[model samples]
Target chain A: MPNFFDLNVHAYPETDVPVEDMYRIAKRYGYTGIAITNHDDTEKGKEILPPSISTFVFRGVEIRTKSVSELKRKIKLHYGEVPLLAVHGGSEVINEAALKDSRVDILAHPCGEKGEGELSHVLVRYAAKNGVAIDFNLNAIIHSRRSDRARILWKMRENLKLVRKYKAPAIISSNARFIYDLRAPREMIALASLFGMKKDEAIHALSAIPEGVLEHKWKKKTEVEII
Target chain B: MKNAKCKVQKSKYQFVFYILHFALLLPPSLRERKRYLVFEVISEREIDKRELLEEIRDSIYSLYGDVGASESRIWLIDYDKKKDVGILRCAHNKVEEVRAALACIHSVNEARIGMRVIKIAGTIKGATRLIEKSV
Candidate 1:
């Protein structure tokens, strides 16, 4: 069976829910692993790794930048500081920049409220070549309803079509601020189908893509050479 | 009057027999195939059976529209309030649709909740067994 991984769970202090509780709940939900992602500005003091409860827990950072220069600066500063680096992407310039940066693992929420979409054919092509993954955040789907929900789904479908066309890496995540927001893996896969994703593709996004990113981090940290 | 009453009774008996014979001859393809989903509802407040059914229906109807909701054929088989575990029934082909709708649901009457699907079974008995083992 393919293992499931959630790549964008927010840690404590970012939300009142403790990070340990998030791991426990995620484990109970059958997630193979979870990455505790904290936003750059709020991440302060010594970041402590929560005790491992037999689930693979990785520390990550979400960087929000106003301009391309700021994005580059943050990636430069935070590279090697954390295993995973995600950029809060909504601005067109920022999205493009993040996609081209090999150091950036994920570009989160590229399509925000009032925004048409963040990825274009050109940007998606770059993302495919650069190995940057476009995030399909489920938070919008959970929070919106009626017309608002329809609009968000439309934007997501549009992005997904481009992602599939270009063969760019797509990562599906709850973008969950707390444990309650986390969804079961099978549930997420079914929801992904509404946006035209095949079951196998959704499974790849939830499992293989995130696993590959984590493996890259591990390799870098350990300086391992595989034969 | 006796003859007329005898004719009516004879016709009623034939009708009942014919209906039963036809049903027995019906092919499996003509029968409705059902799938049972065993799920646990995680929430802060206790939810009643009626409320749970209404909330799930409303979520599916809103997300997928009347046509999709009807096609899904959603029904509650069993619910345990204390355990917050339940088994739901739907068309076999529409299982994914039901799962998708359940995932979209985040709250019920201001109570935040999450649903986890533990098993999908072909029979109600199998689903009940799975629920017993899980719960």
Candidate 2:
């Protein structure tokens, strides 16, 4: 089995559940590792990694901001501080800004948590060039029903098309706040299928792409050193 | 003559029993192929079997609609409330579709829950064995 990683999970200060609880459950669910990417606004000061579980629980930040300039500053602030830098994407402007910057890692929920954002081919091409992986948060699909779920699936389908055309890296994350929100990797692949993602593509998104993102495989050497 | 009559009567009864068996149970070739999925659930509190089954059905209906739900042919074969694990059966070709529906269910009767399929098998016996090994 390939090593599966969930790069956008929230825990501790973001919610009531602690990192240890999330790590234990994620390990039980068969994940190779999980990144605790609490929202920057909610996080209190610098997060100290619990030494015991540090190997499997990666510390990351999900920058949630409105203005483009502030987003840029935050990216500059957190770039090399953490192993993963996820931008909470929504709105046309934020999507474009995040994708354009090569420093940004994964763009979590490009369509917004509620399926409110949009991405065009140009933005996707930028993501391709910048090596910013577009995240498809399956929680949106799992939580919504009826028309809301339909809309999210439709938006994801459109985004998937763009990602495919540009050959941009894509990742599927639970984006789970609580332990109950997590799903097994196979279930994630099945959920991805709901939005037109093929089996192989979903597997790659859940495993290979996230691993590459962790290793900064697509990042330029100079960009890495400058941080 | 008596032995021959007894043997003939026994043969006739055997033939009738075979016909009845075929009539009551579909022949293997004609039977619909099914897969058994052994799954585990983690929830806020104990969930009743009926409630969980209802939620599963509702999820399938809402996600796939009537026609698609019918094609899946979902059925709950066994559930151990204490263990929070169960065996569900569905059409062989519809496993993935059913899996998606199962994943869509985030709650049951207001109790938040998460579910995952542990293993899938072609027979209930195989699924049960998997459940044993996993537990």
Candidate 3:
């Protein structure tokens, strides 16, 4: 069976949730692994994490940059250090830069604040070619209500439809800062369906896509060691 | 006065018998199919059953609207106070809708809470069995 993984969990220094509690709640929610992505500047580098019972913990960095050159520099600096590197996508420049770069594993929330300019077919096609998975964050859904939540969901559905059409990879993450924000794999799957994703596709987004990223990172690490 | 009292007693006994007869007479297809969802809530403080149900209902209503909420026929089957585990009953077809709503619920009465669905079963008995094993 393919194990489920959440690739963008924030805890400890980045968020109020302690690392131990994040791991505990994630495991309880049936996640086989969790990638704790903290801001790059917050901590020096990937520090030693506490031992988990069975859940595999992976270190990741969320890069927030202004210009293309800055984003590129951050990616090159952190690519070898962390198993996952996600770009915080809200600005048009950042979204384009992140999609075109193969080093960035995920473009976190492309439609977050940028309305219609969030993503286009050309951008999504480039993402497909570069193997950058667009993120569908669950935090917006969990935290918002009324008109705000509806707007977020509507924008996400548009992104989801385009991503599916372009045959680009899509991944779902809780992007949870608090333990309460975490959800079970099955629950995540159900929520994805509301945004035009199929059941099987949602399952793949949670498990297979993130697992592929992990495997790719593992290969890179081993190859470097051998050389 | 005596005759009136006897009639009232007979009518009460007849009402009970009538309800039992109708309940037995209902067709299997007419009965609502139920699905039990087992879940655990992790939060700062203990959550009461009343608040949990209200929050769940509100979420369902917000996401799916009033019609979907009514169609869901959501019910709290049972909850363990200390363990913070509960079994929720809903219409069979509305299980996914209910699950989605439950997943989106992050807080109850301003207290942050995390809910994890343990198992989903077609019967309350099966759901309870899964809960015992997991707990």
Best by lDDT: 2
What C-alpha lDDT do the candidate models reach, one value each? 0.85, 0.93, 0.84
CAPRI rating of model 2: high
List pairs with backbone clashes in candidate 2.
none
Better of 2 and 3 by lDDT: 2
Report the Cα RMSD per candidate. Answer: 5.8, 3.5, 5.0
Task: Looking at model 1 chain A, report the run of 10 residues with the lowest lDDT sum.
Answer: A218-227
iRMS of candidate 1, Å? 0.9
Runs off by more than 4 Å, candidate 3 = A44-46, A51-55, A113-117, A217-227, B1-25
**Candidate 1, A1-227: lDDT as tens digits:** 78899998887867777777788888898899988888888866545664555347888899976889888998999999888899988878888899888788888878864345567899988887767778888878887888878887888899999998998888999988766689989999988988788999999999998898777642343233333
Docking class of 1: medium
- The digit string of per-residue lDDT tens for model 2 on B49-131 reads 99999999999999999999999999999999999999999999999999999999999988899999999999999999998
Candidate 1, residue B83: lDDT: 91
lDDT of 2 by residue, A59-96 (tens): 88999999999999999999889889999999899989
Which residue ranges in model 2 land beyond 4 Å of their true spot? A221-227, B1-19
Q: Second chain of candidate 3: TM-score?
A: 0.80
